[model samples]
Target: MACKVQKRVSLRRRLHILRFLTNSNYNKLKVALENVKREYENLIATRRDYIRLLDNNVNDNKDVKIVKISEGTFMVKVTCEKGGGKLVAILEAFEEICVNVEEAKVSCENEFSMEAIIVSEDQSLDVTYVTEVILKAIEK
Candidate 1:
């Protein structure tokens, strides 16, 4: 009985010390790697936003564009000749992607242009996918 208890205590102490030594260094490295990865992701997102800003209005005879302005925000620009109740459907599509409109403006100078600033809680939203969805909505 005495030998069993000593062995169990020795095993427990060894496990505790092993865990403490491994977790500190391992956890620190893991956290640093995660932080760097997030920063890289955000940097990629920023570059995409910059590129879109330059060529954002490329109509090419198409309507609707979802452009990411920053990490958690996007600008949705849509052109429609018929501007009665179509904005409602576009807004619905944006909401489906978990976005809230921060601001919206409509201007018509031979072409109706609707610009909306949208924000989302999700930081990893796929910019291209959302743009495609908005394009389909505008197409309809």
Candidate 2:
């Protein structure tokens, strides 16, 4: 009878230890998740600030922005107050410049906006010249 009581006490002690460890682990996981959430929010805020800075530096008069992403890849963005056949015209201009459009996203609701990823075979593709060509196309 004494041995049975001792076994029951030992079992209860072990269960108590297990419950404590489980709670400790749960608390640790909760803290880690909170930290990850904080980092994600900080990242989002930094991105928003970066985008705002870019917007502030942009020339309102010009509706085109072309950035050289890599050696032969360019990211093109165009925004205009008018919407019509601008998409077709811009694609035609890209064809003339001999740049392949790998991906393009266009929004023509109320206004016109286009973002394109262009890959050029010509390593010497001039950004200034491409900007000028796209500007001309937008004007037309």
Q: Write the per-residue lDDT of candidate 2 for residues 58-96, one digit (tens) a residue.
A: 434457888999998999998875554888889999999
Point out where model 2 deviates above 4 Å. Answer: 1-62
Q: What lDDT is reached at residue 75 by model 1?
A: 87
Q: What are the lDDT figures for the candidates, one per model? A: 0.81, 0.88
- Measured over all alpha carbons after superposition, the RMSD of each candidate to the real structure, in angstroms, is 20.8, 13.6
TM accuracy, model 2: 0.55
Give the clashing residue pairs of candidate 2, or none: none
Q: Model 2, residue 137: displacement in angstroms?
A: 0.4
**Model 1 ranges off by over 4 Å:** 1-60
lDDT of 1 at 3: 100
TM-score winner among the candidates? 2
